[model samples]
Target: MRLLAWWSRRMLSAALTLLLISLLIFAASRLMPGGFAEVVLGPFASAEEKAEVSAKYGLDRGILTQYWLWLSSAVHGDFGLSMITREPVTTEFGLRLPVTAELTILGMAAAIVFGVPLGVLTAIRAGRRGGGALGRLASGFGVSVPEFVLGSLVVFLFSRYALGLTVGGYVPFGTDPAANLRAMVLPAAVLSVFVIAVTARTTRDAVLTVLVEPYIAAAVARGESPGSIVRRHVLRNASIPVITVLGTVTAYLLGGAVIVEYLFNLPGIGSYVVQAVGRRDYAVVQAGVLLAAVVFVVMTTLTDAVAGVLDPRFGRSA
Candidate 1:
C-alpha cells in the first residue's frame, strides 16, 4: 500500500507537470511576436481569406478562449489542423515524430553502449588511486566538447571514410533500414558523447564509494573475483547515478535532435518544428512543442519505472 501511494504521487506529479508544460507552450505560442493571421496567410491573402482562416481556427476569439478550445481539442485527440497544409496537425506529427523518435533511440543506445563500461572501469581505477591520465583525458574530452563541434569532427572522420560521400542526413528506416542507420550513426554517436562522459564519471565515483563499504571488502576477502564483485555488488549500488545520467541524456539528445535534423535535413519532428518556427506556422509550432514536452515527461516517467524495477529499495509498486 505504501508503494502504491508512492506510485500514485509520482504519477500525479507527472500529470501536473505535463499540464503546466502544455499551458506554458500554449501561452508561448500565442506570444510569438506578430499575430498568427499575419504569419499564416502572409500579405498576399485577401482580407476575406484572412478573416475566414482566423474564424476557422477561432482566432477571432480572445487568446485565452482560443487556448482553451485548442486545449480541449488536444484532450479529445484533435491536435488542430495545420495552418500551412490545411491538413491535420496530427497527421503531420504522425509522419514526422517517428523519425525524431528513432533518432533519439539511436542516440540513447549509443550512449549506454559506450558509457556503462567506461564508467565501471573508471570507477574501479578511481577506487584504487583515482583515474590516471588516460581516464582523466577521456573524461575531460567527453565533458568539455559541445555537440556541434563534436558532430563536425565526427562528420570529418566519416567524410574521409565515406570517400566524398556524405552520411549525416535522415533516411526512413522503413524505406531502407540500412541507409537510415548509416545516415544516423555518426550523428547519434556524437550526440551521446557527452552523456557517456557524465555517466562514466558519476558511476566511477559512486561505485568507488560503494567499494569501501564492509560488504564489498567482505566479498573481496572471500575470494570473489574482482570482475564479479564489480559487476554484481559495485554496479548495483552504482546504477542509480548511471540511470539518472541516462534519463537526462535522453532529454538532452531529444533537443539535440534539432541540430542534427537541421544539418541532415531529416523530416523528423525536430527539423519539422524548426522549419515551422522559421515560417511562424502556429499549428505546427504548437504541436511540436507539446509533443516534445510530452516526450520529456514520458521519458522521465519511464526512467522512474525502470529504476523501480531494477532497484526495489525505492519501493516502487509499478
Candidate 2:
C-alpha cells in the first residue's frame, strides 16, 4: 500500500514536471529568431503570403491558445506537420526515437560493464599502499575530455589512420545487424566516457566507505573471503549510490547524444532535433523535448524503484 502511494506520488510529480517542461519548450520554440512562415515560404515571399501561412498554421493565435491546441493534439499522438518537411512530426519522431534509445542503452551498458568492475577493483586495491593512483588518473582523464572532442579524436585516429573503421554514417539494425553494431560502437563509446568517469568515481567512493564499515570488518574477522564479503555487504551498500549515478549519467547521455549523433551523422532523435531547431520546426522541437523529458523521468523513476528493492529502507521510508 505504501509502495503504491509512493509510486502514485512519483507519477504525479513526473506529470507536473513534464507539464512545466512542455511550457518552457513551447516558449523557447516561439523565441527562436526566425519566423517559421519566412523559413517555409522563403524571404522573397510577399507579406500577404507570410500572413496566410501564419494564419493557416494558427501561428497568429495567442500563445496560450496555441499551446492548448498543440497539447490537445499531442495527447492524441498528433504533433502536427513539420514546417520544413511537411510530414507529421509524430512520424518523424517515431522513426528516430529508436536509434537514439539504442545508442543510449548501449552506452549505459558499456559504462556499467567497464566502470563498475574498474571501480570495484580500484576500491579493493586502494586499501593497499599507493594503489588508488591509476583509478584517479583514469577518472581525471575521462572527466577532462569533452564528448565531442573525444568523438572527433576517435574518428581521426580510427577512421583516418589505424583501424580504418567506418565514420559518419548509420545502418539500420534490421537491414544489417553487423554493420549497425560496427557503426554504433564509436558514438556509444564517446557517450560512455563521462558515464564511466562518474560511475567509477561514485562506485569507488561508495565502496571505499563500505570497506571500513563495521559489518565489513566483522566479515573479515570471521574468515570470510574478500569476494564473499564484497558480494554480501560492500557491493550491496555501494550499489545505492552507483545506481543513482547511473540514473543521472543516463539522463546526461540523452543530451550528449545530440552532439555525438551530429558528429557521427547518425539519424537519431538528437540529429533530428538539431535539424528541426535549425529550421524552426516548432512542432518537432516541442515533441522531441517532451519525449526526452518523459524518457528521463521514466528512467530515473525506475532507478529509484530498483534502489528501493535493493534497500528496503527506501521502500519502507516511502
Candidate 3:
C-alpha cells in the first residue's frame, strides 16, 4: 500500500511538472519573432495569404487561447503540423525516435558496463601506490571535454590514422544491422564519455562511504572472502546513490545527444530538434522538447521507484 501510494504521488508530480514544462515551451515559442504564418508564407506573400495561414494554425488567436488549444490537442496526441514541412509532428517524431533511442541505449549500456567496474576498482585501490589514479584521471578528462570537441577529435583520429571505421552517415538498423552499428558507434562512444565519468565518480564515492560502515568490517571478520564481501555487502548498499545519479544521466544524455547527432549527421530526434529550432518550426520544436521531457521524467520516476523497491525504508520515508 505504501509503495502504491508513493508511486501514485510520483506520477502525479511528473504530470504536473510536464504541464509546467509545456507552458514554458509554448510561451517561448510564442515569443519568437514572427508567427507561423509569416514563416510559412514568406515576406513576398500577400497579407491575405498570411492571415489565412494564421487562422489555419490558430496563430491569429491570443497567446493564451492558442496555448490552451495546443495543450488540449496535445493531450489527445495531436501536436499539429510542422510549419516548414507540413508533416505531422508526431509522424516525424515516430520516425526519428528510434534513432535517438538506439543511441541513448548504447551510450547508457556502455556507461554502466564500464563505469561501475571502474568505480569499484578505483574505490578498492584508493590510497595504494597505483591507487586508481589512472581511472581518476580518465574520468576527469572525460567530464572536462565537451562532446563536440571529443567527437571531432575522434573523427580526426580515426580518419587521420586510417582506422577504416565509418565516422558519419547513419544506416537504418532495419535495413542493414552491421552498417547501422558502425555508424552509431562513434556517436554513442562520445555520448557515453560524460556519463561514464559521472557514474564512475558517483559509484566510487558511494562505495567508499559503504566501505567504512560497521557491517562491512563485520562481514570481513566473519571469514568472508574479500570478493564475496564486496559483492554482497558493499555494492548493494552503494547502489542507491549510483542509481540516482544514473537517472539524472538520462537527461544529460538527451542533451548531449543533440550535439553528438549533429556532429555525426545522425537522423535522430536530437538532430531533428536542432533542425526544427534552426528553422523555427514551432510545432516540431515544441513536440520534440516535450517528448524529451516526458522521457526524462519517466526515467527519473522509474529510478525512484526502483530505489524504493530496493530499500523498502525508502518507500516509507519518501
Candidate 4:
C-alpha cells in the first residue's frame, strides 16, 4: 500500500505537469510570431486572404474557449489538422511514433551493452586502477558532440564505403523489416552515444560509492569474490543512481534524435516534429509537444518505480 501510494503520488504529479505543458504548447502555437491568421492563410496569401482564412479556421475564438476545445479534442485523440499537410495529426503521429520508439530502444540497448560493464570494471578498481579518467573522457566526448556532426560523419562513411547500403531515407519496417533496420542502424548508433556515456559515468560513480560503504568492506573482508562483491553488494547499492541517470538520458534521447532524423530522413517523430515546426503545422506541433510531454512524464514514472524495486533503500539511503 505504501508503494502504491508513492506510485500514485508520483503519477498525479506527472499528470499535473503534463497538463501544464500541454496548455503552454497550445497557447504558444497560437501566439507564434506570425500568428494563427498567417498560418491559416499559408504561403503567398494576401492580407485580405489571410483574414478570410483566419476566420474560416475560427482564429477569432477566445483563447480560453479554444483551449477548452483543444483540450477536449486531445482527450479524444483528435489532434486537429496539420496546417501544412491538411492531414489529421494523430495519423501522422501514429506513423512516426513507432519509428522513434525503435530508434530510442535500440539506443538504450547499446548504452546498456557498453556502459554497465565499463562502469562495473571501473567501480571494482576505483582508486586502485585509476581508470575513472578514461571513463570521464569518454563521457566528455559523448556530452560535447551533438548528434548532427556524428550523424553526418556516420552517413558519409556508410554511404561511401559500405556496399549495397542506401542513404538518406526511411523505409518502414512493416514494409520491409530488413531494409528498415539497415537504414536505422547509423542514426540509432549516433543517438546512443550521449546516453551510453552518461550511463557509464553514473554507474562508475555510483558503484564506487557503494563499494566504499562499511558493509561492502565487511563483505570483502569475509572473502567475497570480486564477482560476488559486485553482484551481491555493489550493483544492489548503485542501482538507484544508475536508474536515475539512465532515465534522464532516455527522456532526452528522442528529442535529441531530431538532428539525426533530419540529416538521415528517417520518417521518425523527430523528423516529423522538425518539419511541423518549419511548416508551422500547429496540429503536428501540438501533437508532437503533447506526445513528448507525455513520454517524459511516463518515463519519469517508470524510472522511479523501477528504481524503487531495484533498490528499495534509495530514498533513505545515505
Stretches off by above 4 angstroms in model 1 are: 40-53, 127-130, 153-165, 254-256, 316-318
Instruction: Tell me the lDDT of candidate 4.
Output: 0.79
State in Å the error of residue 249, model 2. 2.4
Off by over 4 Å in 4: 36-44, 129-132, 163-165, 314-318
Each prediction's total of clashing residue pairs, residues at least 3 apart in sequence or on different chains, is 1, 0, 0, 0
Q: Write the per-residue lDDT of candidate 3 for residues 1-318, one digit (tens) a residue.
A: 777788889889999999999999999977888766666667789999988877876678898897888889999999999888789999988888888888878888987899999999999999689999999998888889998899999888976786767878789999999999988888889889988998899999999999999999898889999799888999889999999988888765664388888888888888888788767788888998888788789888878888887888877887
Lowest summed-lDDT stretch of 10 residues in model 4?
A: 309-318
Model 2 TM: 0.94
For candidate 1, what is the lDDT?
A: 0.75
Q: Considering TM-score, which of the candidate structures 1 and 3 is the better prediction for this target? A: 3
TM-score for predicted model 1 compared with the true structure: 0.87
Look at candidate 1 and tell me the lDDT of residue 281.
Answer: 75
Q: What TM-score, over all chains together, does every model reach?
A: 0.87, 0.94, 0.94, 0.91
State each model's CA lDDT, in order.
0.75, 0.86, 0.86, 0.79
* Best of the two (3, 4) by TM-score: 3
